[model samples]
Target: MADKEVQNSKKPPSKSVSVVNKTSSVSEDTPKTVPNKGPQVLCLRILNSLNENMKSQKERFEKLESAQYYD
Candidate 1:
């Protein structure tokens, strides 16, 4: 019984990238929506600054992964 259970567990499960048997034209005509570009640029700059800031902080705090994490 244990061996049967192990064999069943070891069996690979199936996964589908696509779903089947939909009634409607569930396919999208086009993708939806847009995001603000300004925030993205700001985020990039902030992330870069964070990396720089963390480099020094690690020496002060052994727990810190990076000095940039504080900023």
Candidate 2:
């Protein structure tokens, strides 16, 4: 009886094992909404501000150079 039990335990699961089926409710036509624009907008704003600051700094340096050349 003990040997029979061990043999049964060694056997693989039957072919009739239940398979879990997963179905997605999302369809292809459904438009995916963006999660957040806060970070993206902040990054763009920071880039624009940096560009403007660089332009101003360049203008100031050029003006200083012209003044020194005239002196």
Candidate 3:
């Protein structure tokens, strides 16, 4: 039959199924990555220092402004 002939002309989907199975097994055997937290903690400390510096600078500028207006 023409339908049988068409089916025979196309390659089967079995290879894709085997590929998926292979990837699943490989992923199971692979080790997952552990993230480094040291740098992250250091970065947080640096950001906090920068924020404190900015707050102090803002307070100093406000004091100067008030002093100028009072003179």
Candidate 4:
């Protein structure tokens, strides 16, 4: 009876180890299945272009204001 109990205890540890291995493997695969970054990249590009346009507009406005002051 003592031997049977020892064997059962050993079996549970092995099962727990296998479960841990499976969870680790699943976690490793998660990054590979990540959503595509295409939309995020496109949005960043658009925001950058808008920022550039805003800067140019501000420069033009400043130039016009200075010209009016000099007139």
Clash pairs of candidate 2?
A: none
Task: State the lDDT of candidate 3 residue by residue for 6-27, as single tens digits.
Answer: 9898966664443344321223
* lDDT (0 to 1) per candidate: 0.59, 0.72, 0.65, 0.64
Candidate 1 vs candidate 2: the lDDT winner is: 2
Better of 1 and 3 by TM-score: 3
TM-score, one value per model: 0.32, 0.49, 0.48, 0.49
* Shift of residue 44 alpha carbon in model 1, Å: 0.6
Q: In model 3, what are the clashing residue pairs, if there are any? A: none
The better candidate by lDDT, 3 or 4, is: 3
Q: Weakest 10 consecutive residues, lDDT, candidate 2? A: 24-33
Clashes of each: 4, 0, 0, 0
RMSD for each model, in Å, please?
17.4, 17.0, 16.4, 15.4
Give residue 43's lDDT in candidate 1 (0 to 100). 70
Rank candidates, TM-score, best first.
4, 2, 3, 1
Q: List model 2 lDDT by residue over 1-71, tens digit each.
A: 99999998998877887889995433435433445688876665566666667778999999999999999
Candidates 1 and 4 compared: the better one by lDDT is 4
| Model 3 TM-score (2 dp) | 0.48
Which stretches of candidate 2 lie above 4 Å from their native place? Answer: 1-36
